[model samples]
Target: EINEIIRHLNNSAPGSDNLSSFFFKDTIDYVASIITHLTNESSRTGQFPDILKEGKIIQLPEISNAINFSELRPITILTVLEKILEEFVYKQLIDYLDEKNSH
Candidate 1:
């Protein structure tokens, strides 16, 4: 799961926190243990840190660069940590499905 989470980190632009995926990629080992613990805790308690919930909603212009809000595409930029945890959840779900299908 750790490796899968690391693999899913995107090389996208940073958010307001100014944290890039590279930062997590470079220091994954140092944070892996804690991340694993957090994942387990979150899974058990159905809760996660509020910091992970922080995100930025940015609007991108449509094909014609229209000023109307309806023509803009909104994208949410979540923290790198959140992204990693999300990937962990995704892997867990996929593994569960695979195991079920093998039965």
Candidate 2:
């Protein structure tokens, strides 16, 4: 998913001399960092409770407001989905590890 973003950014920019490349790279890095943080937090806590409390989806206005759809011309929804998948896998791996350790 990150690769696809980079590919698209590179294709769209068509030159390394532009600042857009840096922006795209930074955005990808930021997304990766967020995914890692969320995964680690969820793993330690056993679930994403802040995101879902009492079976209700929590509305994170800060995050929602930060993501400007109008300015997200090159960003695809798949990027968010991929990050979610990564977080889920990380949590599952951590759970498996904990279970093995307990046994």
Candidate 3:
């Protein structure tokens, strides 16, 4: 489900459209929502999966060394979330991003 969203966004490339700004904003919002959801779910369940557990710190240099967002699919996002939600800390990360993105 998540991979489908990424695939669709990449295939449609918002830059190609007159409504590129809107598309970009919507895409960002959608991606943010997914992140937010995963974080919240992870917090409640204490079941952060290995990948997300590995990505606990968003600012890690290792993150940059890991998979690139440009190459990520929705399924990847889902997998990451599945891993992340296994831990309780992911909620904090989601809250931070939500607060930042809200403004």
lDDT of every model, 2 decimals: 0.83, 0.48, 0.43
Residue 43 lDDT (model 3): 59
lDDT measured at residue 16 in model 3 versus the true structure, 0 to 100: 16
lDDT of 2 by residue, 1-103 (tens): 3344343443232222233444545577566566557557876887764323212122333444446545333422223333344546766679889999999
1 or 2, greater by TM-score: 1
Better of 1 and 2 by lDDT: 1
lDDT of 1 at 30: 79
Model 2 clashing-pair count: 0
Model 2 CA deviation exceeding 4 Å by range? 1-26, 50-83, 86-103
Q: For candidate 3, write residues 1-103 as lDDT tens digits.
A: 3333333443221211223333434565466467557666755796654543332222223344556665433321223233223332544567789999999
Steric clash pairs (candidate 2): none
Better of 1 and 3 by TM-score: 1
Q: What lDDT, from 0 to 1, does candidate 1 have?
A: 0.83
Give lDDT tens digits, candidate 1, residues 18-95: 889888788888778888899999999999888888899999888685878889999998877788888889878999
Enumerate residue pairs that collide in model 1: none
On the 0 to 100 scale, the lDDT of residue 66 in model 3 is 53
Candidates ranked by lDDT, best first? 1, 2, 3
